[model samples]
Target: MYGVILKIINRLQRNPKRAATWQYLKFIRLNRETKPLILYPSYFSVFLILGFLMLASSKGLLSKDINEIGDSVAGLSGVLAFLWLIVTVLLQNRDLNLQYNEIKDMRAASESQAQSLESSQIFQTLEYLEVKLENISEYVRQRRNLIIEELENFSRQNRIMYNGNTMLDLVDAMDYFVVNSSDKDALEFELSNIRNDFTYQSYLRIQAIYLNIEEVVVAYEALMINVPENIKPQVTKYINAHKKSLMVDWCDKMLPYTEKLRHALMRAVVKHGIGPEANRHFLKIFAEKDG
Candidate 1:
């Protein structure tokens, strides 16, 4: 019963709109209150006790028989009862107003918390991103030296190559040689945009890694005709093994740019030791993309 009283008090205190409601109004008709309905019996009992105390105290001026009680004393008791009822009604109204304000404040706090929760998002820590960059840097550090080896082996074959060309020059030349030349600056700007775009940067990085692999492919294929017929199979086997690394790691990333890279390889083949027909070789390797 005590717990039930507490629960009713909590409801009225937490939601004051309920305090002045019709059900509360009906309860308030007894000069009562939105004061947790469960406390009604206790409050009524207190009033009765107070009434009995006053009547007992008036016994000295009172007649022994109930019918002989003085009119003045009876009127005073009625006034006291009226005063008690009025005091209870005023106190209930003041408490209900305070509770309504408290409820408004609580609601505001809840709304702010909900907005904060909605706007929150998960973010990668700097350490996590740094670790990923370190891993990529390590792999590139190991693999790029092999590309230099392929070029050096070509110089051993009595061919003049690259003409002091850098990787950047080769890529820039490719745009002109394969795709047409008038819009180099525009293409460069667009590539910069792709690099900066977080959504596309990962794809761009994979493409760049594959492009490095393609450079080695071009160097190797360009020299296929230069090898003696007996040694050509060995060279093919060696180059195939190297190319497999690119396929395993990057074939999917390279698919979109396959034709562009192939054209670069074709230019290298004609300029070094192969003819137009050797283009079929690139087709074979690129065809393995699906597998």
Candidate 2:
């Protein structure tokens, strides 16, 4: 019997679950899997007491007297309970330490995965913003080329003319007189008016592009910071506030340029709206750009 108990203890030392069970037999813990061990031992204790009662009636070990049998059973039960309590406490501590180590490893893996995902998101956003900026820059270059070409053509072919009194009119009148031909005055006046109008329009367009680029850069910076999910709400609030500060009058200022760009982009998108074709195009653009 002693050899069997020693072998059981040895096996339990190798098996955490079985060891947890042996410990629970003494500890009476409110744990999920091991608590059943406490109940099994209580039932076994009752059975041992009953067996002692039967043994005294049959004149078995210790003494045939009922009082002596009861006293021996009580003493042995107390000794067994004390040993069980000590063993179980040690086992419970071991289980708790193992659980703590497992939790720490899992938390580290989770943090690493989170960081990798966050790095991926930042790389993608940066690539997208860089491509968008490149497109805007190309558009601005084309638009500026158009304006410069128009200004040159107007200067070569037309003369300035004016009918009213203002600082702008005075400048046009001076240019009209210097042109040296009666037929050129009307054309020059119209050219001057167009140049002034185009200048104002181009200034507004360039300012808007600059502002949008600033917003994109700010958003990219926010994305690159660690723990984006935890800080995203605060970052978004600041980014949106900065964006709002750039331009508040959406009705008078923003709609025309957005409408023109949106229409042109929609046309481009519709032309390449197929499966692998669109995917390949996006990959090529995103991969080649310096984000």
In order, what lDDT does every prediction score?
0.48, 0.48
lDDT of 2 at 46: 73
The list of candidate 2 runs beyond 4 A from truth reads 1-61, 140-291
lDDT of 1: 0.48
Tens-place lDDT per residue, model 2, 1-291, is 999999988899899898888788756543444555565665666787687668666766554577876777788778678857966996798889989999999999999998887777666655654565445444434443443343333333344343332223323322332223355443332322222212222223333443443344444354445634654564455444433443221222433433333232323332334234665476346434512
State, as a TM-score between 0 and 1, how close model 2 is to the true structure: 0.33
* TM-score for each predicted model, relative to the true structure: 0.28, 0.33
What is the Cα-based lDDT of residue 239 in candidate 2?
41
- Residue pairs whose backbone atoms clash in candidate 2: 23-88, 159-188, 159-189, 160-188, 160-189, 161-189
